[model samples]
Target: MFYAVSAVVLGFLLDLALGDPHWLPHPVRLIGWLIARLEQLIRPVLPKTPRGELLGGILLTLIVVGLSGGVSWCMLHFAAVYLGKLPAYLLEVVMCYQLIAVRSLKAESMRVYRELQKGDLASARIAVSMIVGRDTEKLSPAGVAKAAVETVAENTSDGVAAPLFYLLIGGAPLGFCYKAINTLDSMIGYRNEQYLSFGKFAAKLDDAVNFIPARLCALLMIAAAFFTGLDGPGAFRIWKCDRKNHKSPNSAQTEAACAGALGVQLAGNAFYGGVLFEKPTIGDARRMVIPNDIRLANRLMVVTSLLSLAAFSLMKLLIIFLLH
Candidate 1:
């Protein structure tokens, strides 16, 4: 357990030192390939009955989970044996931490802000498009800001907190497996006609897995806002009142809290793949979203990350002391 925790810490530090490199093999990508292969193998065996399909989905999910766990275990165990203790420890930590992308999220988000700052609406739209799933072709400056801010808030949970939570609970192998499941859901989990039935399991499983982490992330962000001298109460109110606005039950919770904390309204109508989605507005209509809000969101995200780390460390220490 100590080794597992140490590996997660080291993996995080390594990821901070070295972001994802194009030259090396990415574990997430490898896991994605495994999922693809499993899907192919199971497709032909899918039963005609709903019960059969449900059973098949469960079996498929288990296969994915098993393969992911197996690979992570092999890599971590091999590193521990062949690499020096410190190096192996660091490698494990780096691997675990790399799964969280708070820094890259901030960077990408800030780039959109910078583009908007230069009055480059087109460039800003392009930058925002890279981070969000919505259409950016006709977005105004404020629209771009809102989209970027919302993405930052929602991903703060999906891309960062969720992975860390899994690590704290079960260490690197489980953490990596959680990420694999998440990535698979992101790729295949859709409500569109094509994926509605076929991707049902992936979508539901992702929702179930993310349920706790999303709320925890919202609380973390709220705490972070308070620490940063933002209006925590405002965030809480918005979260409670407007969390139901978005189509995604969990995602809206965090994004609404963030919008309220930042004192900006977010969500209206957005297009995705030419389909329009109308969402209720979150936050009070007090302030217009500007480029500075993106900067503020980034700052809040940094605080949230630090707070989560501190909390994790303290919990680990308490566990060790109790065991001893």
Candidate 2:
């Protein structure tokens, strides 16, 4: 537990000191490649029947879970010994911070803001495209801002809270395993025809694992909003009202609170590959979204993350004291 907590803190500081480097190998990317390779190996052997698909999927899910868990345990154990306790702890902290995308999220959102500030709509559209799945080519400034804010809000839970929750519950090995599963889901767990069956288990497992963490993320965002002097009542109200707007039952809860806290509406008709997805709007639509909203959201995310860390640290200390 000490090593796990230390790694999270150190990893976060390292991320702050050095944003993602292009040259370094990302563990998530490595895990994703492994998942792809395993899927390919299984594909050739499976029969072309629904029953076969179901059986293959169950086997694949078990393989993925076991392999990921085993790998994480080995890596953590090696790190603890080879890296030395203090350095390993620091590395773990940095690793944990890497799991959260708060800084990257802010950077991507700011890129759009910078383009918009220069009055370069074309460039702003392109920049926004990097971060959101929605059609950005036709977005107005408000639309772009809305997209940035909404993405940040939703990912705050997926990219931060969920990982942290797992880390607190089961330490570094479990945390890394969760991140591995999340990476696999992101890479292959699409509803598209190609991945629908192949990635079914990954997607469903990801959803199941994230259920509790997502709600906890919403609560943390609400608390952070109140701490930051935002409209707490409005945040709660909109969160309750729009919690079911998203396709994922959990994502909407956090995004809705963030939208309301920032006093901007989020969601509407979004297009992906020219297909339109009409989603319910969250929060009031009266307030206009601006670049500053991204900054505010980032601020809130940082505060919420810090609070979570403090709470977890205290819990760990209490456990130690009791055990001793």
Best by lDDT: 1
lDDT of 1 by residue, 1-324 (tens): 577666656655665567566686777887788777877777678766656655655676677777787777787788878886776666667678668777678889999999999999999999999999888999989999999998888888888778877887777777877887787677667777655555678778888888988888888889998999888998998988998887776888788879888988988778999899776788887978998999988888778776776677567768977999
Total clashes, candidate 1?
10
CA lDDT, every model vs. true structure:
0.80, 0.77
After superposition, the stretches of candidate 1 with alpha carbons farther than 4 Å from their true spots are 22-24, 36-60, 81-84
Model 2: ten consecutive residues of lowest lDDT: 88-97
Error of 1 at 299 (Å): 0.7
lDDT string, candidate 2, 1-324, tens digits: 455566666665666667666687777677777777887888779986656665666677677767777876777678778887766565556556666666777788888888878888889899989987778888888888788888888888888778777777676667777887777677767777667777788788888898988887888888889999887888898988888887776878888989888888888788877888777788888778987887787877777766666666677667877888
Every model: Cα RMSD to truth? 2.4, 2.4
Residue 199, candidate 2: C-alpha displacement in angstroms: 2.2
> Model 2: residues >4 Å from true position, as ranges?
1-3, 79-84, 319-324
